[model samples]
Target: MEFVITGDGSNTLYHPEIGEHYHSKHGALQESRHVFLDMGLHHFLAKEETNEVSVLEVGFGTGLNFLLTADDATRRSLQLHYCGIEAYPLPTDVIFATGYHRFVQPATWAAFMQNYAQALTTEVDFAEHIRLKIAHEKLMDFQTDDQFDVLYFDAFAAIHQPEMWSDQSLAHICSYLKPGGIFVTYAITGNLKRSMKALGFTVEKAPGAPGKREMLRATKVG
Candidate 1:
């Protein structure tokens, strides 16, 4: 594992053999805000109204997505089951060193960060509305027996991690999505769109979040 500081002192991580990359570039806090909160949660809220929502995230780096999702669940008083997969997880020091609280509010940041740490290292409910479970394995190793209402496919860009966006993974993901379930992602590569289409998804190009022109959201057709 190698780490580099982005232009703004945010951390970016790379795993050479595993073909994984994470940007703490905006910090994990900012990345989650832009990628998951702004892109995933915003889109989810606009389309659905449910007492409970299931979310599956592809890359569980920094636990930022989980924190944000848990916070939303608490705010909306909605039940949330967040399932994520990560082959390699960073240590707590690496996570804390990124200075997530600097971007997020200080009060909630401590509680959120504590939950985030406990969620990664243990499998238990940290609160009433939110449950976190990490597969602690490659995404490909996980079976698609359980379907989710939404999937946050915030993997590294297709260019940076091609295998993670392959047809096989898309197929696996589709099998885990209910009909009409939505999958949101930050990458807008043409090959990725084709792969999702091949896996029986009705793909759409959605408005991108910050630092990008467009993102992808594919729906499973009933």
Candidate 2:
């Protein structure tokens, strides 16, 4: 993995093995904020009356999504339980070298890093309202009885990891969502939309982030 600076001045990792970047070359933070935080988490919370929100992230990559959600939860004073599943965990040095702190407030960076470190081994309560758990497992092998209100499907493109976007894999992931829960992803392929619809989700196209043309947002109907 190599550190590459994105268009928005955020750092993303380039996986030479797969020839894919962890995030968009256009902008790492920008893409994450637009696709996951805005379209996934906030969109769900806006219509729901509860102060507690649960999020399941498909790829924990550089912990950018986790940090963004943590900051948002803190600002809104919302109770957030975040579960991140990653098959190949990045090294501590790689994470630190990404310089994610530049995108976050200085005061919270220390605590976020500490919580991130502790979260590797076990779940950690990062703040009064934020709880984080990182599971070092592939999405296909992951099993959980817990239901989530939102899912950040930040997996690599289907071309790179086709199995992750398979219909069966999607159905398995959708089974974890509570009724009416939202699922958001950067990829907006025809097959993906069909897969979500077949699994009982109300799928729609959304404006993509800076570098992309379009994205997908789906909600569990039943």
Candidate 3:
């Protein structure tokens, strides 16, 4: 993976093997903020009056989503339980090199860097209000007794990794959600919408980030 400066002056990694970037080339930070943080977490928090929330993220590529969420949790003094699934984790040096720390609170970034490796082994208290864990495994093999209130489907696009967006894969992933759980992603396609509908989710197309025209947000009704 090589770092490339996105259109918005944020950095992202280009995965040569996958033939895709880790985030939208339009803007890495903007994509994460728009899709996962604002659309996913904020929307859930807005709907429910709660002091705590649980989120599950697929394709925790650069930990940008986690960092941003942790920052918001700190701001609101809200307790956040975050879990991410990454089939191939990045190196510690690479994560630190991303310069993503500049985008979040100093404490949030420090705590995350200190606990990132440990989070792979077990959940860690990332901060006073944040708990983090990263399951270093494939989506199909990930199992958790805990159900999440929000899910961030941030995997590479179907063009690059078709298996990750397959209907069976969506079923396995959505099964971890609570009945009223919210699912958000930086993608919206006919097949994806149909898959979510078949899985009992109320899906809607949301405004996309800079490069794309639309994204998706869905609620688990089944």
Candidate 4:
């Protein structure tokens, strides 16, 4: 993996094996804030009246989404519980080297850096209102009774990891979302919209981040 400075002056890792960057080259921080935090979490929070929110993130490569969401929740005094599923978790050093700390609150960055490894083994309350757990397993093997209010589908592009975007995979993942839940991703395609509709989500086309034309912001339909 090589560190590349994005157009927005943020750092994102380029994976030689996958032939993909962990985040958008247009901007790492911008993409996370636009697609996940703003479109996914914030939209849900505004529509639903709740003191606590549950978020499930796929990929979970650099934990940028989680950090931003946690920081946002802390400021609002909202309780947030997040779960990230990663088939191959990054090393502690790689995470520390991402230079992502410059974007999040210092306290949040410190807590995440200190408890990241522990979160891989078990859920940890790293801050007064933030709890995180990283499932060190493939997405299919993940089992949880908890149905999330927001789902950040941050997997690699379907071109590189087709199986992760297959109809069956989409169904299995969406099954974990409660009715009226939010599901957001940085990519939008005809196949994706069809799959989300078939799986009972009211999908919409949202404005994309800097590099793309559009994104998918879907709400689970009963």
lDDT-based ranking: 3, 4, 2, 1
Q: Against the true structure, what is each candidate's TM-score? A: 0.83, 0.97, 0.98, 0.98
Q: After superposition on all CA atoms, what RMSD does each candidate show versus the true structure?
A: 2.9, 1.1, 0.7, 0.7
How many residue-pair clashes does candidate 4 contain? 0
The global Cα lDDT (0 to 1) of model 1 is 0.73
The weakest ten consecutive residues by lDDT in model 1 span 23-32
Compared with the true structure, model 4 gives a TM-score of 0.98
Across 1-222, the per-residue lDDT of candidate 1 in tens digits comes to 777665555556766775755754434445566767666666676788777888898988866677667777777788888888887777877777655565544644676556655666666675666677777778789764677888898777777767888888878766888877888887788898888888778888877654667778887787
Global fold similarity of model 1 (TM-score): 0.83
> How high is the lDDT of residue 221 in model 3?
98
Q: Which stretches of candidate 4 lie over 4 Å from their true place?
A: none
Which 10 successive residues of model 3 have the least lDDT summed? 121-130
Select the stronger candidate by lDDT from 1 and 2: 2
Per-residue lDDT for 76 in model 1? 78
Write model 2 residue lDDT over 47-114, tens digit each, in one string: 99988999999999999998888888878889999999998888777777788887776655777767
